[model samples]
Target: MSNIVALVVIRVALDRDDQQLRRWERKIAFGYRMFIGLYALAGASTLPVAWLIARASFVSYVQSHLLYPLVLLAVVEGCVEWGLSRLRRGRHTLLIVTGVLLASIAIYFNPRLHAIESILLLPILASVFFLSPKKVWLAGILAMLAECILYWLNPFHGHESGTTPYDLITFIVELVGETVVCHGIIARGAEIWEELRKRGRLETELLVRQIVSEKDAKTDALTGLYNRKSFNEYLEFALRISAETDTPLHLAVIDIDNFKQVNDRHGHLVGDDILRRTARAIEYHLAAGDFLARYGGEEFALIIPEMSHEEAVAHVEKIREKIANIHHAELTTQHATVSIGLCTYVPGEDSQALFQRADQCLYQAKKSGKNRTIAHP
Candidate 1:
């Protein structure tokens, strides 16, 4: 019984956590349909047997009283079905509660209504399917109270009233049987729901971790820029776009001036700081539609799509000036500067060809002097 109760509680909790309420609605509809079908089948199977027993006992009053409450319960349950179909969360709760209370009262009042005890099954099913764990607990409390009241007001009790120990035993057995069956169904449903929810949460977490891993693979750790692999991919994409649009593209190769010297003078830590600061300055000076990547070591590459050789050179000069102006707090030595080599795309040119031209211009910049931009036609 405790295990069953725990399962029901878990199902109720899953229902609340389901962000998409359509799932909850479908569950409710299926639960109600099952209840209706099961009860209808039970009624068809037992009504005739009950009628025959009542007639043999010379108790025709049993048939009329029992039939009346069953009809009323069926009607109330139909209303609950309709309410669940059309209503949303809070409104659905109200309708279901009203239906359960009506059925409980009707069963409590009818003298021959021991047969109507099946009405309680509907609420138990609803508690599992639609209501949350908190609501299931509340419904359990209400059902217990109703049962106590009905037992106290029962008019068939007494040794002299032709009622024997067998009759009392039968009544107690029926009550316990109904309670156990209803509670068990709800509990099992809840357990299945909780297991599914746990699996769903785990799957979502795995998906998030997978996405973060992919992002990390493509990004540089130091500069927070695209790494060499991503840079290659972007360069291929840019070349394709430039070819399609028949637009001239520019490639710039930038190298920090005497980066090894900075490392030896200030320490590797300060050198790393300077690299980060220079990357930021370069990023700040770049125009929209321009992209920069950490090519390798202390070198970076820029792709300026739809720009001519002269325009690319001007942009690279601005980046060089920006790097020269960047003040690093950890730098106890001289200011940092960068040199750049710019080249323009030609028809049918591949990434290697463009990189070679840019490298040649970069070599020229280093030969002429550092802290400058050199361009190749």
Candidate 2:
């Protein structure tokens, strides 16, 4: 029995945690899609500028070289935007390959134009959106290395060329500086994402803990019913609402008949079983909108909203009959019964007054040969 209860509690907590995690994933995925859309748009916008520059220069070599790869990159971005899973499945390699090919073609056309090497930074920056710090670092380093090889292989190197060694040195310095800044920004974003996940998990845990605590505070540990404290608070609240709405409130105070004799004959453990069984039997007879609580030792209280005095008496009588017919194996006499006192609350009356009247009826029921219901005159 205890194991079943523990499993239920654990399942509830796990369900809450899973819900929180899914919410975070949805937010991150949304942001990632937006980033991809902007990136694709940026690439598409650059095509017009590249086209005009190539046409004015009348350099077929530059025009063909730049146009083919820019179009290919646009296609690749579309694939990535439509299916981000492709990025995780190694399709990101297509992006890196396109970037390297474009840089190599530019360098091949004008080997001495060291400024063109800055184009390599595009692939490095694109990898930052992957949210993987290691991927970003690796892409940046590989891009720099690829540029270094091209620089050494340039045909005009060491010649009296327009591009001097100082230009190459300055380009490398700027590339390294930009890579550092980009890496720091990407790493910080990853940290912030992780922190949001942690905060969500903590908040879920706190909410689950609060629910469990509130339930425990109101429940009777032994009978598995609302305890006396909960009963009092609910009764008062119901009275106030009924008064405001002009609705009738019916209250029944039930006491187990001969409960002490059962305890003396069969021991307290068996008596406890009878109490629990009797509570279950009474609860089965109640309908929706009715409140049942363990009011005291071997006693329970029921609150029926929107019921008149006659209807309330009939309801309590049914519960009394049910309890009288219940057979319990743990009871020495093989049967148990309850005496119920029924009363309808008067409008504008305090809860204490209502309870006192109910108590008086309960006393009268006990006095007049128990196991029957008594309603206030």
Give me the candidate number with maximum TM-score: 2
lDDT of 1 by residue, 322-370 (tens): 7888777666645888888899988799999999999898888988989
List model 2 lDDT by residue over 1-377, tens digit each: 44554555567666875665445434434543454455346545656776777766645544444455445545644554455444445544444444455455545555654366777776667666656666666667777777777767777767787445786677767777877888898889889977875676566566667787899999998888999999999998999899889998988899998999999989999988998898898889897899999998998999999877788888889888988888888766778888888888987788888988988899999999998888984
Q: Where is model 1 more than 4 Å wrong at Cα? A: 1-99, 102-120, 130-137, 147-179, 186-191, 308-311
Error of 1 at 216 (Å): 3.1
- Give the per-residue Cα lDDT of candidate 1 at 58: 35
Global lDDT of each candidate:
0.71, 0.74
Cα error of candidate 2 at position 21, Å:
9.3
CA-RMSD of model 1: 9.4
- Among these predictions, the greatest lDDT belongs to 2
